[model samples]
Target chain A: MPVNKPFLHGQFAKRGIKAAKGITGIAVLFIAWQIGASVSGVSSYFFPAPVDVYNAFRDMMHKGILEVYLLDSLYRYVVGVFLGSLVGIGVALALGLNKAIAAVFAPLVGFFYAIVESAWLPVFVIWFGYGITTILTLLIFVVAFPILYNVLAGIQTLPIVYVNAARSLGATRWQILREVILPGVLPSIVTGFRIGAGFAFRGLIIAEAIAATSGIGFLIFDGAANKQTDRTIVGMIIMGLLWLIIELAYLRPFERATIQKWGLVTTAEQREVQ
Target chain B: MIVNKELPKISVDNASIAYTNQDFAEPHLAVKDVTLEVSANEFLVVVGPSGCGKSSLLAAIAGFLTPQGGSIKLNGKQIEGPGADRGVVFQDYALLPWKTVLDNVGLGLKFRGMSKAERDKIAREHLALCGLADAEAKYPHQLSGGMRQRAAVARTLANQPEVMLMDEPFAAVDAQTRMTLQEELVRIWQQTEVTVFFVTHSVEEAIFLGDRVMVLSSGPGEIKAMVDIDIERKDRDLSSLNSNPRFQALRDEITRLVRQDAA
Candidate 1:
């Protein structure tokens, strides 16, 4: 009647345990880093202590530098990832639905996939120059590739039964794409999103460090140049925490609700072997 | 509705299907020169050994495979591809896992441009008919194997297809559940004037459920024999299937034909 309440309750309990483990794991790492710094007798500039880093975080927060940089980095990341994933999924559907178009783009996609992010960086800088345009463009370019590959893979890996059953039910081509293909590929889309989000984070930092004037990446660089190691350490910790929070709060729950929880759609590569 | 009692619903005329290969491997022949006919509203069951190409034959009828040799026709019109008039229940109950039972059942209706409320109402009716009254909101994975198959059946029935193609729809279920589903399927078949082409490996199941049973030979499947059960007019009693003398005779005859691999 209600789709098995006990299973849902059990999943909740498992999630609690997983969250506890994650918290404990982060706490242990922090403690180890503090101990290692103290034992090595490293200068505060070389390796700032936990308290020093915490104080730096507090000072930056008070001065509002942290807030501006954090917001700047997050805004770029959010917009870039969203735009890139949209383009990626669009291309994937194109390739998936039609073989002739896929044949034409297959080699191009492969070649572009082989090109490194840095390879495009130099040319992009020349075209867009050092500013939000260059950074945003670079971030989107880098983020879109992985999602494109992943979504394409998702499309290819879809079960044949889904298509056959839908067609048998008299679904037209467009109807099949919307009703069957879209839902079938969503699990892989989310997987690609997680992977692409990770790439976006790295791309954001790199783009900021090289092209933009303010961001977490800029903070790390600015601190090093200005001999504010504590601020750099603060930046590093925030980046890790931000990614961790996003993963736990958004990506994971979305996956759980859509794919893993539904218990259908393997989305794994093995299903595509045929 | 294509409900003409005198016309054959689907006709297979000397159709042969071969699977081609791109590599050095030899192309395989799955079904060879198979011929059969299903009249309107007839529940025709097909039984054969493994690798008999029963599934391939069914797929050809569903328009997933094209015949290399002859042709298939529906209502005197040569079959081109899959259509709404012919609904298929796959061996593995191909319910879209993302959708709830209600959504999956109403999927065909959605394609037909029925409003959501009307589709859901029709879906609910079929679900109830299949003894899944309370499972309309449950996702496919949430249901047991028997329930999943039932939902698949309901989904097909809701589409109101003229011909129902079932590829061993109960093979995945346990014996008890299979028997129950078989009985339920018979009851549903009797209620509607829909023709059914059911494929199964079990002789007992074929005899218990079919008005006529078609037996196919192994490897590159061809018709071995076609047996009329003659029990369609009798009281349908699945529980006494094993003990019924006529049921046993039919089962034995079909089993013997299958064991010989030819009539």
Candidate 2:
């Protein structure tokens, strides 16, 4: 009859099994890849085995190339995403609060959102010219639109009752904005941030490939150009692993602390029913 | 018992409410030429059928809507907009999901720039008053409908408003919970001097909770009748009221008035 204790244990057991299955899957893939490369008789440059890629990873770590490139990539990602998210939230609140301003700018924001971030990159490179400025601009552009759109959507869907309740509770306009509007739209802001962060990650790699002399994007590109295929494979693996870390460590915890804790997801579902 | 010892707390004269629908060129009139006065500390209940503008009338008093034709005044001051002087308890229990029950109750004090320690102390007192002392740290989503409404009531009461505007506050809860809440509300009203203006569609609710019930006719709502209940305050519980002759007569008369408008 004690449901909670057993349910918690069951959750832990389920997680353990899932982790074990994931490790097994990777082990199987690595063994198959190693065997296939050895039997194929192709040059390791063309089809490097898992062990060769591991060697290249060790080689880069010894030479400090991986550390430097990773730091550079992380710096760009943090600065770009932070600035973009601020701008997106700011513009969203400005337009969302005022009808006249929203009417004037909503269409323009939509028009820009329609154009892909990649298209803007060439123009950014032309304007800022092949450096951190161009890359940062591209990353910011990629991150802002999704966040802006989602936050606007959040503002639109927010219930009027919350505002009315706050007003009657003696909240000033500024107090309402701080206490009511911002918190009400927080779930949407988190959703937008997740999407924007993904787009920024991809944009960083592409921008570095085209514009920068450093970062993981450059490492991957330069490796393939110099016929160091194992190093290219190492860079690709790092990219995938880095994203997993960001998702699990940063995004998921943020969601767990805020939106999930507030039970806004269930609240949204209830609103839909109404 | 203290119905008219002083000036009327809220006065409305020839108030009309209309709404402009995008699809319709003509503005839909919800309430027309309504005039009413609520005395200090009076428990006034507005009861009517659907589309009777009972809610519109409450909204006007709460300052969410401005009466197009006439004026609504509170304590001889024109009601310009919403203020802490007049707190509203909504039907949906508009406690912020992100805030704990204590924080929601303390929100008005927070807006007044009260210290967290001071606000929390006051908030806890109100939570205890509402029988929600154990639920102070729980979020709104964690509370049941009745509890949520109770928290909302505590929230408005904590703000120390002169008048409490309740727009069908207990309508969303189950039948049993509604009865319990109604009794608790009557008890709470007795403890505080805050005047109550409650709106509902249930005639039984009107009779059991209100000192006087004002019934409104159907759309473009006008006052159909005003009935004063003679049941003793001590006999206004679900069990006692079920057999009280005065309670039954008032319920029947108000039900007939509401049904006539619906018909």
Q: Residues B129-247, candidate 1, lDDT per residue (tens digit)? A: 99999998789999999999999999999999989999989989999999889889988999998899999988888888888999889988889999998875555587666787877
Q: How does chain B of model 1 score on TM-score?
A: 0.94
Indicate the residue-level lDDT of A122 in model 1: 77
Candidate 2 yields a Cα-based lDDT of 0.90
Q: Please, what is the whole-model Cα lDDT of each candidate in the order they appear?
A: 0.87, 0.90
Candidate 1 lDDT tens digits, A15-94? 78977987999899889988998999989998888988999999999999999999999898888888888888898888
Pairs clashing within candidate 1: none
Model 2, A1-274: lDDT tens digits are 3857989798679768967987899889999999999999799999999989999999989999899999999899899999899989999998988999998998999889889878888989899999899989988888888888899999989999999999999999999999999999999898899899989888998899899999988888999999999988988888888877887688767776788789887532254388
TM-score of chain B of each: 0.94, 0.96
Please list the residue runs of candidate 2 whose C-alpha ends up more than 4 Å from where it truly belongs after superposition. A1-14, A266-274, B1-5, B21-26
Clashes of 1: 0
Q: Tell me how each candidate scores on DockQ against the true complex.
A: 0.73, 0.85
Docking class of 2: high
